[model samples]
Every structure is written in C-alpha cells, then in structure tokens.
Target chain A: MPTVELRFAALNGHVRTARMIATAVSRCAGVPAGAADEIKLAVTEACARAVRVNRRHAPQSPVHVALTETPDSFTITVADRGQSGDEVAPGPDGGLVTASTLLDLEPDSAAPPWWSEPAEEESEADGGFPPGLGLALIEGLVDEVQISRGADGVGTIVAMTWHTGPAVAPSDSIL
Target chain B: MDLSLTTRQEGNHTVVVVGGEIDVYTAPKLREQLIDLVSGGSYHLVVDMEGVEFLDSTGLGVLVGGLKRVRAHDGSLHLVCTQERILKIFRITGLTKVFPIHSSVEDALAAHE
Candidate 1:
C-alpha cells in the first residue's frame, strides 16, 4: 500500500489522472473495474469541489490529491486552502455530503450543493455553491466520505474510501 | 476507441450499432452520426450498444440530445444495452427511464413491432 501524491490545477487533465489512479488502485487491490470507475469518479468530484472552494482565497491555487491504499481499503484525499466560517471546523462535510447525495445516500438535510453557479453579487463574497448535480453523484458512488479541516485553516481535506471486496480480476476486454 | 455506425433494416426499424466509448471527447462523433441518421429521413433508430463498454456524463448528454432531435423528427430512439457496466451507468443516471432499453439487439428489434 503505497501513497501517490498528485498536485495540479482543477483542470480536465487531472480528472483523467484521477481515473487512471483509480484504475491503478483497483488493479493493485484486485477490485472490479466498475467499482474502480466509481471510486475514480468520486475522487475526481472531491478534488474538483476542493478547487471550487479554494477559488475564494486563491482562485488559481493548485489542489493536492493523495491516493493511499491499505490492505483493506483505498483512500483518496483532496485538499485545498479555504476557511468557511469556523476555523476549527472539520473538513467540508458539505462537500462530503454532496458526494454522498450522488451515491444516493442521505446527508444532512440542510447541506447545500458543493459547487454552485457563480452569482452576480455573491461572486465577491465567496464562490457560493454552484448549482449542479455532481456532488450527489459522487456521494452515491463512494462508500465512506469524510471532511476534515486543518488546524491552522490551511485547507479542507475531503477523503473518500473504497473497501476491498471479493476480488474480481480485470478482464482482458471491457465488453 | 473505434465507433462504427451502420444501418441495418430489421423489418421497419433501422438499427445502428455503436462500438466504442461514448464519452465527452467522443460524444461529438456520436452526435454527428445520429444527426445524419435523423436529418437524412432515417427514423426508427435503435442503438446497439453491445460493443460500448463505457459511457460518461458527456456521452449521456449526447444521447439525451439525440433523443430530443429524434423526437422532434417524429422518430423514436431505442437502446440495446448488454454490457453490465454501461447499463449500470444508464440505470444510475435514470436514463433507462428516458430511453427504451432491450436486453439484446434481437430483443430490441422484436419489440419495435
């Protein structure tokens, strides 16, 4: 179980890289291809959410993605600097909540979308949640999603976990 | 990924079997192909996805777009999804509700009547 750290802007290329990392993790962990894709989508959404939140402080800040695999589970963490209201608050539960909603799991009823469309006046206050359905999709696919804030308001950490199940060898072909 | 679109007459329906990943980068190709089928007065489109192993949001958008175009042309679009992964995506996005899906190409053809 080695860890891979990837730092990049929340760009399209990193989305593909997140997928590749998921495939690699699944290959190494002996998971099914579909499961791997689900993991990849969840992690990619989390990273994108982090970048969206970071836009308030450092719009161009490079988001950091860490993929770590253990014997029993694989964890992908997306981190970026931003402070919501509580400096000592845990990682963005709202983000994880969005991810869970995508997975069809119930998060806090009051939680809003992770990323919202930029509003005319609110754009200066903070990029309020962008109205989209991505977070809900991520939540539906991932098993356990958690959010934790750093001690010094350095960043928010969104972690997604996929547990090892009955090993399904990758087939030679998808179809 | 290689996508080949061919029209085969199954009684009164035209079946177009697509073979490849229908994603964002490749969806435009699918859009073009579907547009040709519709604009050329070719209706009764049945997409055979036996060879499609993967699909993403962009791909789904293209399919939705195709559905809209086909509807406007007074035609219908059907799907032949045999691949589990692809089917799963359809089901997750509730696309199975939007399009008619059959177990196989033969089933799709038979159901058209």
Candidate 2:
C-alpha cells in the first residue's frame, strides 16, 4: 500500500490545494478517470468541512488529510482539531451557521423555490443542509463513508473509501 | 485556480460568464458578484459554467444562496453547464432539480425568455 499525508492551515484557500493533491494521488494510484473526479470532489468537501469546523472552534489548528491506496480501493481521511458537533446549529439570528453560512449574512428570504422545498424538508429530517448535503454528496460519490471522532475525542475525522472499479451510479435519495 | 466573471445583458436577463475553478477559496468572489447583481436589481441571472474546471460544496452553497436571493425577488437563476464533472456535482447534490441547467447559453437564454 502507498500512503500520502498532508497538514495545512484550516483555511478555505487550502481546500483547493487538498483537492489537487487528492487528484494527483488518485491518478497515480490507477484510479479510473471518472472515479478520479469523485475522489477529488469528496476530498474537497471533507477538507472544506474540516476547515469550517476548525475555524469555528480552534482557529490555530490545522487540517490533516491522509490518502492511502490499497490493492482493492483508495481511502481518504480528513481530520480537524476543532470541537465537533454532530448537528448543524442555527446562529443567534435563526440562520444556519454551517458550511453554507460562510457566505455573507443576508436578510432571510421567503421560502425556497418549489423544487428546493423538498431539500429543506430533508434537511429538517436529517438535521440541516450543510452537513447533510456535504456528507450525502460524499456518500453518493464514494463507495463507503465513515465519520468518527478524532483520537482523544477533540475533533472530527471524515473517512471515505472508493473501490478500484467502476463508479457507482449516483442515487436519487441524496436530496 | 483563477476565476474571472463577466456579465452581459440580453434583454431581461443578465448573463454571467465564469471561468476557472470554484472551490472554497474562490467561491466568496462569485458569491459577492451574485449578491451585488441581485442587490442591483438584476434579478434574472444565467451563469455560464462551461469555463469552470472545478466546483466543490462551498461553490454549490454559493449558487444555492444566489438562487434563494433571486427567488425572493420573484427572479430566477439558471446555470449553463456542459462539463460532466461539474454537472455531476449538481446531480449528486440534487440541485439538478432545483435549478434549471442548460447545455448552452442559447438554451439557457431561451428558457429564461
């Protein structure tokens, strides 16, 4: 097996570098071209989430990304040294403060469009859209996903695996 | 890595041509542009993603936010994307059903009209 590890500041800008490294490693590990895209996006999401969490709780910490290639699959693990909350919480103004809230704060708008209403319902049922969509996308793009607390229970680790074969068809249940 | 955004008006719609990768780092720029457009009363938007090489959750979130902003004003946001890799992100996130996506600028404009 071959492994690669990287540690970088928990900033949004570093997410792109993380994705680039994942793409390069996956390509070198013989991951199919189509699956390479999935790996890139999944890793990017995981790193982005880690950055957000670290920024919220431990601004000085760095995000750690590890990629390992086995004979059967490729594995990626993104870790953050921030306080991990399993659920997305609303800010004081009743708006979500998850990854989506990284955008500038704007006045609350009316209900989302009809097509997007289902997503809001799904978010309510699953907690919220930030973690919900990010994890759902990772699960949809990869063969397996495992989220766990970091050693010593200080932060979060998002580990995803992709088999060395054809990519799975994306499921409609992601929404 | 680098993102460039240019806007042109076609009748009642504002078409934004975006070029480059959109990730956590660069998404804020796109977000600011979209918000400025909506605040300026250019509610109807068509974003051309054909030149986009990469998009992640942050980028997607920005688009969703833009959509909500425009929808609040009884306006609409459409996406022009042909790259399978970029389209796959929208499909996986189930945003394909949320925003009207077209393969070409012409198709997007036609649909908006």
Candidate 3:
C-alpha cells in the first residue's frame, strides 16, 4: 500500500501533528480511538525528542515522519538528521530519565539529577535527547518499536508497528 | 481548548462552564480560571464537563485542588460529567466519590436550589 509521509521542523507546536498521523493510521488499521491516541502520543514524543536533538545540533534541521499501512498492520517512522560536533557522552541523565518516567518505564526507580550523574563516553550516536520516554511509549503502545542508527551516523530512525490492526480496548483498567 | 464561565444569583450558586479537553496541556488553563473564581469570592462552583473530550491526571489535580480551595471558603464544587470516557477516568481514579457528578448542566445548575 502507498505510505503516508510528512516532513516538518521539530517543534512543540507540531506535536499535535502526530495525533493526526495516528488517526490516519488507526483509521486505516481499524484500531480503537484510545489506541489511536496512544499511538499518536508515542509518535509525538519520539518526534519531539528527535527535534530537540536536532535543534541542539543542527539547529535548523527538519524531522521526517512516514506512516505505512498494510492489510495486517501499520508502521510509523520518525527520523532526523543527526548532530555533528564534540559528541556529548550519554548516560543515565535527566532528559532521558524524564522521558522514561513520562513513558512509565524505569519501574519504581527515579533517575538521579543529571548534574550529579557521571557521563559515559559517546559512541557514533545520532542526534536525540535523552529521556528515552519516547522509546518506552513506543514500546508500550505498539507491538514493536525499532531504532535505526543510520550507517553514516548522521541520523536516527524510530519505527513503531501496530500489529493487532488497531482495535484497542475502549476502557483500560487504569482508565 | 475552550472554557466558558458564568455566575448567577440563584438563591446561592456560582457556576463555571468548562468545555474542552482537560489534559496536561490544558489543565493549567483550568487552574488559572479556578484560582480567579475563588479569589474573586465566587463560591458554590459548578463545573460542566459535558463537552470535555478527555480528562487526565493533571486535569484531576486541578479539580481536586479547586475542590479543596472552594471548600476552604465554606463553599462547594459540583461537576457535570456526561461523557462516558471522562467518567471512566474519574471512576477509575475514585474521584466519583470525591466530587458530586451529575448527568447534565441543568441538573447541576439546579443543584444550587
């Protein structure tokens, strides 16, 4: 099937766009409204994080979003051009922790303040903020979420899949 | 998100009509409105949630906080929750017991009498 693709500069104001994308995906997949919202939230978080990283690095790069729907499932990919410079080391820091917490990951653990945390060495990492909550949310809301660090180490790709065709329970236990 | 507020001198009541999503992004707006109402000495607040599409924890926090604030002024806050999805969130959070929820705005508005 033909995929849906949209590219826009990553910014807080565009977060709502993710919702629109998710709605399309859900409609195509025949998923529930709540599930559709969850998918939208996850995509928005991931896209926002990518945009944040891009702003910190390139400062002017735009993020791209692609939604592909098949007879059995739907997939979304959020990608941004990676940052270039003195690679900042990654670790259990504030931003990543914040994202994780928002995504309801990390169990009962709270991340220590970033200032007090030790920084690890940086690898050939792409541009993106820490708070891995986007990852967690993608994982929670979908059947699968995959990350692709571009071979050139110049971009990051986040892909999520809804395999059950989007029929989500209307009312969850937690409401 | 949209919010509309109106007060009437019906025996004893100050009603606030809220229409829109009550999520993390919109809760602060509601909080500000509630603060102004209470600070202006308008009590007996009634919140009409009939038009609300969603209500999350942040939204719940504002309601709880508003309830506490109004009660401190020797006043009360009533809610009109007609949306099943919104009500489910309140019920799951056990807020159905904390706030007096009615079926419609007219029913809640008439509560002052």
Candidate 4:
C-alpha cells in the first residue's frame, strides 16, 4: 500500500486541488467511481477546515494531507498547524468523534423561519455568511472519522476513512 | 474560478444557473450574487445547480444564507438540483426540509408561480 502526502498553502484556492488529488488517489486505490464524489466532498471539507484554522493561527504553515491506501480502506488525514484553545475543537484527549456527536449540527437551527433568530450571532460572525456544515457532511460521506491532536501536539488532525468496496449508495447511512 | 454563475429571469423568478464546483473558494461568489438579488428586490430565487460538479459545507452555508436573506422579504429560495451526489449533501445537512428542491429549472419556476 503506497502513501502520498501533499502540502499546500493554507488557502481556500488550494483546497480544490487537494480534493482533486485525493479523489484521484482514491480511485487508484480501488475506490469505486460512484464513491469518488464522496471522497471529493470529504476532502474538500477537511482541507477547508485546515485552511481556516491555518489562516487564523498559523498563517505561515501549510495544510498537510496524507492519502493512504490500505487493504480494507482508503484514509485521508487532514492536519492543520493551528494551535489549540479553539472553541469548536474536539477535546485535547483527541477523542473519536462519532457521527451521532457531529449530528448535533442542529439542522433545525439552519432551518427556515427560525434560522434568522438564534443563528443570527453565528451569521454575524461571518458578516451574514451561513454557518458551516463541514464535519457533519464528512460524517455522512465517510465510513469512519477520527479527530485528534497532531503527533507533535501542535495542531488538529481529522482522519476520514472509507471502506474500499463496490460502492456506498448515496442514501446509505455512513453512520 | 471553480464556480460559474449566470442569472436569468423567468416569470417573476430569478433563476441563478450555477456550474462547476462550489467549495470554500467559490462559495463567496454565489453568496454575493444571492445577497445582491435579495437586496435588489429579486426575492423568488430559483438556483439551478444542475451543472454543479461539486459542493461542500461552504456551498451549503451560502445556500442557507441566501434562503435567510430572501425569507426576510417574505421570499422563497427554491433549488433546482438533480445530482444525487449534491442532493445527498442537502439531505445530510437536513437542508432538504429547509429548501424546496426541484428536479429541473422549469419545475422550480413552475412551483414559484
């Protein structure tokens, strides 16, 4: 099983390239074409999170992505150089984040008629930009998700793994 | 530019045709377009995403923002998306309930009538 590591500037523009490369690697690793879109979307979400984390904390560090192919799964690890002390980050213990936990995205908060109320502060932070759905979407797309601190205890690492099989139906629950 | 945006008017509905990838890098363009349309008085929005090849949370956020903007004026944001890959995002984020998703631009336009 070969592994490929990519380092790109912590910029949103590079997130697409990262995802494209990840999708290409996933295909080469025996992931079905039907699952390519899931890989693409998952990589995009992970890299975008890294980009934002880097921008606010480690502007000079590049976002790191490691795509690895194993006998049973294809895994992508998106790591950021940003420091800890974040509000939304998982615990320092780097606990495994279950799909149910991230599902607290509280879809209803973004629902109509009421999204404009309690979600106003969230919208204001981005100057009216909608709240992000990265992790929740990732959970839906990938087979397994793990969030933890980097080995050097520096930044966050989001590792998403998808089983190498025929294909996972879009309607299939990844949870 | 990973995203392309084009706007057309159809029977009182503003059909925004979006193509290419809608990720963090390109979602802002769509957001700006939606904001301009809402503030400029085009409320009944029908976003045609049939040509979209990719979308992520940023894109989803932009759509949510657009919906909020329009709803401010008692307007509606109907999405025209047929791609299963893309639709999965809406369903996962539970946006399918928040937005009236149609299969085609004509269907969205007709529903807006």
Candidate 5:
C-alpha cells in the first residue's frame, strides 16, 4: 500500500486544497475518472468537518489527512485533534457505522429545511445544520466509511474508502 | 475559483447568480447574502448555480436556510442548476423533493407563472 500524508491547520481555506489533492491522488492511485467529483466533494466535506471542530475546540491543532492507495482501493482518512464525542466508536475494526443511516437523511420534508438545534434556533450561530450531514455525504460518496476514534483515542477519525472499479454514482443512494 | 454572487430581477423572482465553488468557507458568504436578500424583503428567489463547480454540505445548508426563510413568508425559492455533479448532491441528500429545481433561470422564474 502507498500513502500520502497531509497535515494542515484547521482552516476553511485549506479544505479546497485538500479536495484538489484528493482528486490528483485518486487519479494517480487508479481511481476511476467518474468518481473524481465524488472524491473531491467527499474530501472537502471531511476536511471541512475536521476544520469546524478543530476551530471550535482545538484552534492550534492541525487536520491530518492520509491518502492511501492499494491494489484494491483508495482510502482517505481525515482526523481532527478536537475532542472526540459519542459520535465516534472504537477502532475501525472494532466498531463500524451502517451507511444505511444516510437513507433517512431527509425523510421528513415537512421538517426544517435545514438541521438546527431547537435550543439554539434563537442564537443565530451558523443556523445549526445537522452534525451528521457531513458524514451522510461522505457515506454517499464513498464505497465504505468508518467513523472511529483517532490514534490516541482523543479526537475523531473519518476514513472514507473508494474502490478502483466501476464508478458508483452518488445518485444511487436515491435508488 | 472563488465564489461570485450577483443578483438580478426577473418578474417577481430575484435571481442570484452563483459562480465558482460553494464550500464551507464560501458558504458563509452565500448565507449572508441570502439572509440579506430575504431581510431586504425579496421572498421569491431563483439561485442560478450553473457556474458552480463544487458544492458541499455546508452550501446545501445555506440553500436550505434560504428556503426556510422564504417559505416563512409563504414565498418560494427555486434552484436553477443543470449540472449532473451539482444535482448529484441534491439527489443524495433527498432535497429534490423540497425545492423546485429547474434547468434554466428562465424556467425557474417562470416556475409559478
């Protein structure tokens, strides 16, 4: 397996750079061209999520992204130094998430058009999008996704995997 | 490219022409503009994103926010986007059922006309 590591400050500006890198690295790793946009969008979402938490809790910490390529697939791991919560499980092998949760992402169209905290609705803080939206998008973009604790068991690690095979359209989630 | 927002009027709809990528960083800017547009009393909106090269969840959040704001006034917010890449996000998030999406600004402006 070959891997490329990128460590940058948790800033919104770097998210686009990370997306571009994911695209280039995917092509080099034999990921299909059809999946390039999905990879780019997924990488941006993961990095943006990392940047968001890091800015809130660990302003000095950096977002760690490891892009790995194997004969079977390519994996993008985005880790943040912010405090990890119940949202994370054990190690990747010990606990994994069911991407099926993505299917219910927008079940109630009658609900709020965007996600928001009932308590914070009056606070005007970023208008409260669902914390799971990012993960939902990543799961939709990749072949497999795992949300686990970081190496030191302190922060969160989101590992998104994409196979170097026939393209899987993100729209398939609608099917 | 960075985000560039330009607003124009068409009939009763306010068309916001969005170009470039709308990710986390730029999404805030878009949100502010949308809020201002609604605050300025323009309820019906048509967001033209034909030039948007990329859109992430954050951008979607802003669009949703805009929708809710307009809907509060019993108005509508229509989206003008034809790109498969951009439409894929809406499909994956199941937002296609929430907002009316049109392929052209003309169609969006003429949505309820």
Candidate 6:
C-alpha cells in the first residue's frame, strides 16, 4: 500500500498543519465522517506530542507523520527524533511511571472541584510515561496504539490505528 | 486557521463567542481573554465554542485554566459546545466531567439561573 508522509520542524505551530494533512488524507482514503474526526484528533495529539518531545530533547530534529490505508483500517505513525528517557525513567520511589501514571496526579483541591480523580491502577498497567493528557486522549480516540522507540534508538514513535469496519481482513485490496 | 473572540453580555453572564481553530498557536489568545475576564471581575462566564473548527490539548488546558480562575473567586464558568468533534475532545480528556457543558448559550444561562 502507498503511504502519505509529511515532515516538518518540531514546532507547536506545525501541529495544525499536520492535522489538516491527516484529515485530508483520511478523507481521500474514504474514511467515514465520524472516524475521520477521530483520526483528526488522534493525529493532532500524536503530532503535538512529537513536536513537544523533540523540542525538549532534540531541538534541531524534525517530526515525521506517515499515513497508510489498509483494507480494514487507517494507520497513522508519528515519529520524532527526541530522546525518550523521561517516558521510560523510574519514579522517585523506584516505581515505573507511565503516561497514564502522570495523569493520575490529583487535581489541586483549591482549584475547580469538577476535575475527576485518576483511576488508581490505570498508570501501573501502562508503566512510566509522559506527563500530559495527550497520550490518554489519543488512546481514547483510536482503536489501537503502539508506543516504541525510533529505529535509530532515539526519539519516540506513536503508531495509532483506527479500524474502518469489522476486524476481518478484506478479501480484495483497496490500494 | 486563526482564532477570534467576541464578548457580549447576556443578562448577568458574560458570553464569549469563539471562532476558528483552537490549537497551540491560537490557544494563548483564548487564554488571555479568559484571564482578562476573570481578573476584571467578570466571573460568570459562558464560552460558546460552537464556531470552533478544531480543538487540541492546548485548547483544553486553557479551558481548565479558565475554570480554575473563575472558581477561585467563587464564580463559575460554563461551556456551550454542541459540535460532536469539539465535544469529543472534552470527553477524551475527561473534561466532560469537569465542565458544565451545554448545547447552547441560552441553555447554559438558563442552567446558571
């Protein structure tokens, strides 16, 4: 299958453009309206996280986004060239803290009372991760998620897949 | 896309109508407006995001910050968002539980009363 790829500087402003391109490509690939919205949000979060991660560790590196349409799903891969140390590092108590773990932090009591408390066991299952709402949002919007280190042993790669229909493999190829 | 904000008085509430995309680039604009409204003693705020074409984590952060700002003064902040796309962002971040989201400004104001 053919893939659509985009490369841009690791900057906050670029996330919008990445989302626009992802939406366009998803639409062209015949993704449904509701699923297209999911793709848009999921891709935006992925790209934004990549840009932020790159800026923190490898300011000069660029963020890369690739979109591929398979028979049963649309896959988006966002990769950055920044170090992934903090995501995998141990916490002060020698326990692993994952992205979901960071989200488990309690909201300030004096602040708004509506902020919901995190589920206790959620973070421990995912391991130590980044401290933000981005990853959690991506997980909610997509069907499958895989986080891994880049092939070059630097940065992070977030691969998200949204199933277009039932999980069965297509009898015929669309691409 | 760029972001634009317009404010109007609806009875005892201040209604802020937001337009365009709300992402990292445009979130600061919304943040500044909310900050000004809170610091200026206008606490009962209803943000109408029906015109928002896009929303990301940055936008979510600003809304959360605005809620905290208003709550500090014993005031309240409500959201008027009907778009599923926009609503999905709130739901995904678990903000739906935090924000008093209404389908329209009138509904939000009515609830405020």
Best by TM-score: 5
TM-score computed on alpha carbons, candidate 5: 0.86
DockQ winner, 3 or 4? 4
Report chain B TM per candidate.
0.90, 0.97, 0.87, 0.96, 0.98, 0.97
Model 6 C-alpha lDDT per residue in residues A87-111, reported as the tens digit of each score = 4334456533332333443354354
Model 2 C-alpha RMSD vs. true structure (Å) is: 7.5
* Model no. 4, DockQ: 0.46
Local lDDT at A154 for model 2: 90
Instruction: Report how far residue A28 has shifted in candidate 3, in Å.
Output: 2.9
- Show where candidate 4 strays beyond 4 Å: A85-114, A118-132, A165-175
On residues B3-112, what C-alpha lDDT tens digit does candidate 1 reach at each position? 55667777667788788655434556787777777778876789888887556555665666666667666777899886776776666655565688998878887787
Please give, for residues B1-113, the per-residue lDDT of candidate 4 as tens digits. 46899999887889999999888888888888988898799989999998998887778777877877787788888998877878888777666767899998888878767
Give the distance in Å from residue B106's predicted Cα in candidate 5 to where it truly belongs: 1.6
Off by over 4 Å in 3: A1-12, A32-70, A75-175, B1-10, B23-25, B92-94, B109-113
Docking quality band of candidate 1, CAPRI definitions: incorrect
**Native A-B interface contacts kept, per candidate:** 0.00, 0.28, 0.00, 0.39, 0.33, 0.23
Which candidate comes out best when scored by DockQ?
4
Task: Give per-residue lDDT, candidate 3, residue A145.
Answer: 67
Say which prediction, candidate 4 or candidate 6, comes out ahead on TM-score: 4
TM-score, every prediction: 0.64, 0.81, 0.53, 0.85, 0.86, 0.81
Q: Against the true structure, candidate 1 has what lDDT? A: 0.62
lDDT of 4 by residue, A56-151 (tens): 899899999999998778999989987753324342356433232343435454433444433242353332332234665676777888877889
Q: Summarize candidate 3's per-residue lDDT along B1-113 as a digit string, tens digits.
A: 44444445444666667776554445567877877888888778888777766554446657767776787777788998776666755554345656889887678777656
What does the lDDT read for residue A2 in candidate 6?
A: 40
List the candidate numbers ranked by DockQ, top first.
4, 5, 2, 6, 1, 3
Model 2 - which docking category? acceptable
Model 2 regions more than 4 Å off: A87-129, A165-175
DockQ, Cα level, model 1: 0.07
* Model 5 chain A: worst 10 consecutive residues (lDDT sum): A113-122
DockQ-best of 3 and 6: 6
